[model samples]
Target: MADNRFEVPEYFKCPLSLEIMDDPVFLCTGSGHSFERNWLQKALDRNPFQDPITNIRYGDRLTFGPNRSLKAAIEDWKQKTNYHSASAQRPPSPPHRIPEPPRRPFGPFTPSLFPQPQFTPPPVLFAPSFFPPREPVAPPRRPRRHFIPCSPNRLPEHLLSRWEWLR
Candidate 1:
C-alpha cells in the first residue's frame, strides 16, 4: 500500500516494484515503458530474457538504457516536494545522557595520597620593536623552459629544424 503522506506522481513509480526508482531504466521492448533498474534486473533474473510488464520474450537480444529524463524528473519532484525516506522523516530518538558519578570532597579528616596541582594563567608576550612586521611569502618560481629535451637520434631529418629551437 502507498503512503498517503506525500502524493507521489503515478509515473514516478516502477510498475513492478511500485516504488520510486533511484536508477530508472528504459527497456528496449518497444513498449515505451520505464522501470527501476533493480526491479527490472530482478524480473529478468526470474523469467530470463523477458519483459516483466508485456511478458515479451527478448531472448539474448534484451537491452536497456538509463532513463535520464525520467530520473531527472523524479529528482526534481523529490526536491520540490522535500521528500525524505520514512527513516529520515521519523523524529530522531532522544539521546540518553549518562549521569556523572558523585565526587566525594577530600576534607582534612580524609587526606588524599596525590595532591591536585594548581592551574596558573599563562603570561602574554608583546612583539618586540626590533622585529619587523610579518610579510606574505611568495611561492617558488617555476623554470621558464618547461619542455623536455628529446634525443637528436630519435628525431627525423625534416623535424630536426623544429627540434633545434627546443635546444
Candidate 2:
C-alpha cells in the first residue's frame, strides 16, 4: 500500500494557504515573499501593498510576479512523490503459456497445412542438472613407503650411518 502522508517542500508551499502552490507568485514584501497568486491577489485587493502578517507598507509600489524557480521545484517534487507512490502497486506479470487445444490424430495419408505436433516430455520442474552425473573418479594411488625397523640390524646399509647419531 502507498504511504498516506507526503510532505511538500516549504519552498514550494504558499505562505498564505500553507499548502503546496500550483501557481506560485511572489508578493513583493521584504518579509515572506512566497504566496499562491490568486489567493494573495484577493488579499492585496482588500488592503493595498500590505502583508497581513508583516504590516510593513509599500503602498501602491508593491511589485510581484510568477515565481518560476519555486514552481519548477514544486513540479520536480511532485514527480518524485508520484513515482514512489506508483511503485508501491504491484506490476502486471507476463502471460502464462496456454496449453494447446486437443485435436484428432491426422491420418497418415491426409494432407494438412500444419505439421503433426511431436510428443515432447513436459519440461522438468525439479531437475537442476541439464546433463547426467559424471562417473566418480578414483583418486590416484600414492607410492607406499617400506616400513624399516628402528633396530640397527634391520636398518639399510645407507641409512645405518644416519641412525648412528641416534645411538
Candidate 3:
C-alpha cells in the first residue's frame, strides 16, 4: 500500500527531518531558521557543526535556543486545521504473546487435590512506641556586639596629630 503523507505547512516542518517539529528551536544563525531539536542535534552529532538550512559553518560552539513563537504558531495551525501527525493517527501494534498449550481437564474437581496455601501477614517493622516524641528545641542565639560610632570631625588631639604626620 502507498503511504499517505499528511499536508504539513512548510514553515511548521523541520528542514532536517521534513516532518512537523515536535520541539522547534532556532539554528542560532543569521538566517534564524528553525528545526526540530532532536533532528538538529542528531545531524550536528553525526556531521560538522553548521546550519542545515543555510549550510553555514557555526564552528565548535553551536547553540539552538527554543523557538517558542514558531512552536506556538505551529500549535495554532494544528488546532485550526485539526491536523494530526501520521504517527499519532497510526494505531499501536498488538503486543506479542506466547500461546499456552491446551490442557486436559481432570475427571472431577476436588479441593483435596490442590490444597490452598494459608496466607500470613508480615510482621510490622516499625511501631509507634519505637520512636518517642520529644519537644522541639530552639536553636542557640548568637552574641550581639554593640558598636561605638565615632565621627571623623570628633577625632582626639593625639590621634589628629598622628593622622596629620602620616599624611
TM-score, every prediction: 0.49, 0.44, 0.49
lDDT of 3 by residue, 1-167 (tens): 74333467698888888899989998766687888999989877766576676777866767778999998988887787788888889999899999996566655563354576889999999997899898899999989997443654566666677567444
Model 3, C-alpha of 110: deviation from truth (Å): 54
- Model 1: lDDT of residue 27: 89
Ten contiguous residues minimizing lDDT sum, candidate 2: 80-89
Q: List lDDT for all candidates, in order.
A: 0.83, 0.75, 0.78
Better by lDDT, candidate 3 or 2: 3
Give the C-alpha lDDT of model 3. 0.78
lDDT of 2 by residue, 13-117 (tens): 676778778798887665657888888888878877777557777747566788889888878877877734333567977899999986866777877767779
lDDT order of candidates, best first? Answer: 1, 3, 2
Judged by TM-score relative to the true structure, which candidate is superior, 1 or 2?
1
Clashes of each: 0, 0, 0
